[model samples]
Target: MDGHRIRVGTASWTDPSLIQCKRFYPPGCTSAEGRLRYYADKFPLVEVDSSYYALPSARNAHAWVERTPDDFAFNLKAFRLFTGHQTPAKALPKDVQQALAGHFAVKKNLYYKDTPAEIRDLLWHRFENAVRPLREAGKLRALHFQFAPWVTRSARAQDHILECQRRLAGYHLAVEFRHRSWFEGDAAGDTLAFERAHDLTHVVVDEPQGFENSIPTVWAVTSPKLAILRLHGRNAATWNIGGEAASDRFNYDYSDAELGALVAPLRETASLAGETHAIFNNNYGDQGQRNAATLQALLDGA
Candidate 1:
C-alpha cells in the first residue's frame, strides 16, 4: 500500500458514461490491454467485474498483466453459486455438499429447463478453477462471495461460508449479505466475526432503493482491512423497474457533492484499514470515469 491508501481505480475504465464523457480515456477506447494500460497509467488498482460471468481467456489475463505495473492489484467477484445460492440440486443438506457444489458433476435431465444442482456444481467448480490463474499470477486482491437476496443470517449460510473459506485453497474470501437478517445484532456480530476469523475482507455496498438489495450495506459493516465498496447510484423509482426501460436514470452524472459523500467514507476506511478498493457501479454514459478522476484527485490530495 502506498500511504494509508495504496491505490484507487474505477471498477471498469469502459463504463458507459466514461465512453460518453471522455474524462480520461476516449469512448470506445478499451481492449483488455488498452484498459489495463489506462488504469496502470492512472491509479494502481481495478475491479474485474467481467469474470463474474463467463470464463475469460488466458490471453486476456496475460494482456492485463502486460499492461499493468508491478504494484497494481485486481479484485474479482467469485462465481455466483459458490456464495451459497442453490447449486441447482437434489435433496442435499446444508453441512454436506453445500460449498462443495464445485465438486459435483451435473447429470443432464432432459425433462427440465433449469440446470440441476449437480450440474451447477460442476459448472461453478470449473468457474472457480478458471479464476485461479489470476490469483496465481498475483493479480487478485480478493474473491467476493456476495450472497444472493435470499441468504439470511441463518446457521446454514454461516456454516456454508465457513466451509467455503476452509476449502478455498489460496484466496481471500469476502462475504456480502443481501438480506436484512444478516445485519441484526447477533447475526451481524457473528458474520463480522466469521470474516475476522478467516481474515476475509467484507464487501461494502451503497445501493439505490427499490433494488431491495443488501440492508446495512457492505460499507457500513466492513472492517478497516482490505475492502470492496460498490456505489450503486440509487434511483428508488427504478429499483424494481422493468420495461422498455426508456431514459435510464443511472446514466445521470454524480455531482461533486455526491461523489464527495462516498469518497469521504472510503478515505477514512482506507486510512483505518491500511488498504481499500472503491468501485463505482453508477455506470452511466461517462459518469463513472469522471467520478473516478474526481476521486483520484481527492485521494492524491489526501
Candidate 2:
C-alpha cells in the first residue's frame, strides 16, 4: 500500500517527558528493554536522539537489534562533535578522554576542529564500529547530521559535510542545516545540488521561522533512497529558550487541522523518494507519538 512507503514516527521513544507523562507506555513497560519492545510494536521507525549526546556503544546497538522487530528501522542522530556542536569532554569514551588529555589540556567542551587528525579518525572508527550491528541487521536507515546554527553555507562547511560522507561510505547520510544561509537566495540551489552530487538526503524540517538559524521548508528530494520530513512544531517563543529539558524548547501540540494541511505535500514527497519518513520532534510528553499516529492515519485514509 502507498501508506507503507511513508513511515511516520517520533524522534525518540524514551524522552523524559514522554515517560513522565504516563500516557503512552503501559505500567509493566518500565524496563528499557520492555519500553523499546512496546514502542516498536506501535511505530515501525524511531530516531535515536540519545546517540547525539553520547557515542552509542556496540553492546547497546546489539541489544536494540535483538529487541526490535525484523522490519523496524532506526535513524540515529550523529554525535554532537560530528555535527559541529560543542561537545563536552565527558561525553567521549574514557580512552578518548585520556587521548585528548595527552594532546592538550582537557577543556569543558571540544569541537571537531579542536581535535587532532588522529583523534578525529579514532572517533570516526569507533562510531562506525559501534553501529555495525544495526547495519548488519538491516535496521539502520540513516545517520542524521543536524549541523549547528553557526555552520553557515561556506566552502569549509561543505567540505566538512563531504568528509562525513566519505567516512561513512556505505551508510545513508541525512543532512539537516540549521542556518538559513544554506537556503538563502542562490545558495539553496547550490546546497541541493551538492547533496544530490554526494548522494546525501536533504532533511526537510518544519519549525519556527524568522530566526537566523531557522531554515525555510524545502520540499525537494535530493536522494532517491529516502526523504525525511521532521516536524519540530511552531513554538516560536521556545525556539531559542534553553530549558532544563528538550520539551521546553519543542513544546507545541500540532492540531489536526495543521496536520491535514500537510497531507498533499507529504504524499508528493513520498512519491519522489523510495520511502518518506515523517518524524515528529515535538517531544513534550506524548505529543510526538500522538501527532505521528494521527498523521499516519490521515495519510492512509487519504
Candidate 3:
C-alpha cells in the first residue's frame, strides 16, 4: 500500500465533549480508546493533535494500536518541542536557558511565546518516545512539526528541523508552514528540497484568516509520497469580520457541496502527484463527524 493510498479522513483528535459538542453532548466522549474506535470505523487516517499539547502514557498508546485496523494510520502533530513557545522556560535549567538564549535571546517564559533550548530538549525526548506503541503496531503514519506564522524563515528554523530529524530518525516527519514568507515561491525551494531529501511529508492546509499574505493561505504545499489535508472550512467572512474573528479559537465548517467538490480534486491530485491523506477539520460542532461522512461518500462516488 505504499503509493496507492488516497486516504480521506478527519481531524477531531479528541471528541465532541472537548471541542464544541460539550454543550450539546453533555456527558462527553467515553475515553480516548472509545473515540479511536468510533473514528477508525469511519475514517482511514486521523490527525491526532493532543500529543502536541501533552505527552501520553505508552499504556494509552498501546490501546490505540490495538483498536485500529491496518489500513488506518494516525498522523500525529509534534508537541511543544516543535511548537517551542508552548513549553515553560522558567521551569528549565539555567544552562538550558543560556544555551537557548544563544539562539533565542531576550526570552521570557518558554510556555507561551518563547522557544527555548530547554523546551526543545524536553520535546525531543517526548516526541521520540511517543512513537513506541504506534511503531510497534505499524499504525504511525508521520509526525507533523507544524510551525506558526511568527516563525520567520530563519536559519534556526531549518536547523531545528535538521536537529529534529536526529530525534525522529526512524519515524516519518511532516512539516506544516504557516508563514507567508514561505511562499517567496522559488525562495522556499530549499525547504521543500530538504523535506524530499528526508522523505518528510509537508502539510497542506485550507484556512481563511489572519495576517494578510501576498497569499493569506496557510498550509498547502504537498510533495511527499504522503499528503495530509486539513480542510479548515471556508468561513472567510466570519474569520475576517470583527465579532467572530476576534474570538480566541478557530471557527470553520464544510457544506455537503463543498465536501463533494473537495474529494475528486484531492484524489486526482494525489493520483497524479503521489500518495495523499486528506482529513476534514470542521471541528466546530458534531459537524466534524458529519462532514467526514460526507467526504467519505464523495470519495466513494456515492
Candidate 4:
C-alpha cells in the first residue's frame, strides 16, 4: 500500500436503514454501544453524521472512546446552524432553546446570522467543549464544516471561514463547499489557496453534478495534514429534492465502476497529504459499508 495513511469508512454507522440492514453488525448487536463496537472493529474511521442535526455531548464522546480501540478515529460533522444552514429550533438543547426566548417568535428554523452574538459565542464554546473528550482521547479526525448551498463564494463568505478557523484553533477542520461557485472558475484556485493558507482541509467531494448546489469533483489536497473524500453517490434526481431526509437524498448505491474511477485520484491525493480519508456518504442501507470496504481493498492494492 501507499506510505501515507489511507482510511476508508462510511459517513455514519447508525443510519436507520443501515441498522435494519442487519448484515454489517453481527447477531444481537442491537444496543447502540454494541453496534458501535462492532463497527469500530470493521472500520478504522467513521464520520459522525448525527452531529449535523443535534449538538454532540462530551458524555457520548467519552462513551465512544471507551467502546472503540485506541486507533479508531471519528470525523464529526459540525452542527447545521454553525455552518450557515437552517437549523430547527427543536434540534437545539432544551436549555439553549429557552435562552433564545427573544427570537422564539421569529421562526422555527434559524440560521447563523439570525442568532444573537452572545448565543453564537456560547454555541462555539459548547461545540468545542463537547468535542474535548474526543480530542483528548485522540479519536477526533476533524470537525467537518459542510456549509449550506446558498453559501456562495464571496468576500464575506471567505471571511466567515477565516473566522471559523480562528475560533476553532488547534482543531483539524475540513471545509466542504456545497455551492458550485466556490469551485467553478478562478474561484477554485482562490479557494484552494485560502484553505492552504489557513491550514483548513479542503473536503474533496464525489457528488451529483449539474445541480445548482453541486461542487464538481475537483480532486486536490489543500492541507498537508489530511485530505478527505466524501462519496455522495451520483443520484442527481433526489440530490436536490426538498423535504427529504439526508439518507433519502444520498440513497444511490456506488458501483464498482464509480469506486474504480476514484482510485487514481485518491492515490494521488494521498501521496500529497499525511493521511487521506475516503468516506462513503451514500448511506441508504449497507451500501456505504460495502462500498467503503471495496474502496479500501482497491487502495490496498494501489
Candidate 5:
C-alpha cells in the first residue's frame, strides 16, 4: 500500500435491508443525511446504486457532499437508459415521456436506440447537471457504465461505446461489460486494449462462475490511475432469474475464509494501480457492511 491508496466499502448505504438491519447506524441517526454521515465515518468511499434505478438529483448530490468529509468519495452508476438497458417509461421524466408520446404510441419500455438523437442529447445534459455538484465538490470518484448483456462484441457495439464516452466527456468513466462474448477466446486482449486506448477503467467483477452472463474474474488492470473491483456475491441460483429485485440476486455473504483469500490479490492490485476500490455489493441483510469491514481490517493489519 506504499504507492497505492486502497479503499474498501459497500455498493450502497441505504438499501432497505441495510436500514432494516439496524446495527450499522446509531439509534439517533435515522435520517438519510445522518445515515450518509455515519457510513462516511466508517468507510472512505461508496458507490451510489440508487442513481442507476432513477435519475440522480443535484439536490441529493449537494446533500451528500455536505454530509461527508472532504476526503470521502462516491462512484455513481450511470442511469439505466444510458447504458443500453430497457428502461420503463414511468421511470423517465414527464416532459420526456410526453415528447416520446408525440413520436409514437406509448410503449412500456424504451431502449437507448429508441430515443431520437435530440432526446438523447437532452438526457446527457440532465445527467451532467445532476452530477455537477459532486464533481465540483471533488467527491465524484467515477461514473460507472455497466453495459447490458446484449451489447456484445461487434462493430456497432464498439462504436456505441465510443459514442458513450464522447457523450459523457470530461468525466472519469469506468466500463463494465456483462456479456461473456467480450472476453471469450481471443477477444479478451482486444477488450483490454480498447479500454486502455479510450482511457476507460475496466471494472473487474467477482461473481458466480459458469453462467453464460457471468463475466470471468479477470484480474487485469487496464487503468493505472484507478482500478475498481466489485464483489457481487456468488449466488448462482438467482443470478439470472427474472422478476426478482436486485437485492435478492446478490444475497450471499462472504465467509471469513473468502475475505481472507482476497487480501493478497487485492494488495497486488493496489500495488500496481494508483488507487484501488473494493466494493462489496452483497445487499442481503447486513452482509455487505460486515464483509467490507472485515476486508478493511485485514488490509489495515497487513
Candidate 6:
C-alpha cells in the first residue's frame, strides 16, 4: 500500500436497520454518543448520510468531533437541494421554511432552481458554517455530492456542478453522478478530464449496472488529495424501485470472493491518492458493517 492510507467503513452508522438488527453494537451502546464512540473505535472513517436529507448543524458537528478520536475522518453528503434533488419544503430550516411557505403553497417538493438567489446564498453559508467544526478539527474529508439522475452530461449541468465547487471554495468536494451520460462511451474521458481540471475527486461507484442511471466502475483518480470508492451493492432489481427505503434499495450483501476481488483496485487507488476511503452503502441490517469489516480484514491480510 506504500505509505498512503486506505480507510474502510460503512456510509452510515445510524441507519435504523443497523440499530434494529442489534448485531454490530454492544448491549449498552444505545445513545447517539455511545454509538458514535463505539463505531469510531472500530473504523477510522465514516460517511454522514443524514446530512443529505437535512442540513447539518454546527452543534451536531461539534458533538461528532468530541466523540471521535483525533485521527478519525468524516465524509459528509451534500444537502439534497444543492445536489439537484427534489427536496421537501419541510426539510428546510424553520426560518427558511417560513420564508418559502408562500412560494411552496401548492407544491410539496422544491428544486434548486425554485429558490431565490438570496435563499440559495443563505443555505450555502449555513451549510459551510455547520461543517466548520469538522474542518477545524481536521476530521472533515470531503463533501460528497451525489447528483440526481436527471442531471445529465450537458453544459448547464456541468455549470451547476462547477457552481457547487465555487460556493464551497476551500472545501474538498467529491462528485458522484447517477446519470450514465457522464460516463457513456467517449464522454467518460471528458468527464474525468473536467473533474481533474477542477480538482474534484471522482467518486468511483460499484453498483448494479444496465439501468438508465447505472455507471460503470471508473477506476481513475481525478484528484491526488483523496479518492473515494462507494459500494452500493449489486441489487439491480431494487436499484430503480421507487417508494422504498434506502435500506431496501441497497439490500444486497457482498460475498467474500466479491470483496476480495476489489482489493487490488482499491490498493491501486490508494497508491495514487494521499488517502483512499472504501465506503459500504449496502445498509441492510448489519450487511454494510459486516462487509466493511470483512473487506478491511481482507485488505490487511493481502
Number of the top TM-score candidate: 6
The TM-scores, one per candidate, come to 0.76, 0.97, 0.78, 0.97, 0.96, 0.98
Q: Model 6, range 9-46, lDDT digits (tens) per residue?
A: 99989999899999999999999999999999999999
Better of 1 and 3 by TM-score: 3
lDDT by residue (tens digit), candidate 1, 101-197: 5544453111112446665556546656666667777777777777877776777777778766766666777677777776666777777777777
Give the number of colliding residue pairs in candidate 5. 0
Clash count for each candidate, listed in order shown = 14, 0, 6, 0, 0, 0
lDDT of 2 by residue, 183-297 (tens): 9999999999999998899999999999998999999899998999999999999999975598879999999999999999988998889888999999999999999999989
lDDT of each: 0.63, 0.92, 0.64, 0.89, 0.88, 0.94
Ranking by lDDT: 6, 2, 4, 5, 3, 1
The TM-score obtained by model 1 is: 0.76
* Per-residue C-alpha lDDT of model 4 across residues 168-261, encoded as one tens digit per residue: 8889999999999998889899999988988999998888999779998888888888999999999999897777467888988888888888
lDDT (0-100) at residue 232 of candidate 6?
99
Residues 1-302, model 5: lDDT tens digits: 23589999999899988888887888988999889989999999999988888889999999999999998989999999988998887778889988888544756788989889898999888989999999999888799898887888888988988887888777888988898998898999999999988888889899998866778988878888789999999999989878636788898989988988888888888888888999999988789999999999988988
Better of 1 and 4 by TM-score: 4
For model 3, give the 10-residue run with minimal summed lDDT: 241-250
Error of 2 at 147 (Å): 0.3
* Candidate 1: 10-residue stretch with minimal lDDT: 106-115
Q: In candidate 6, how many Å is residue 246 off? A: 0.8
| Candidate 4 displacement at residue 249 in angstroms | 0.7
Candidate 5 lDDT (Cα, whole model)?
0.88
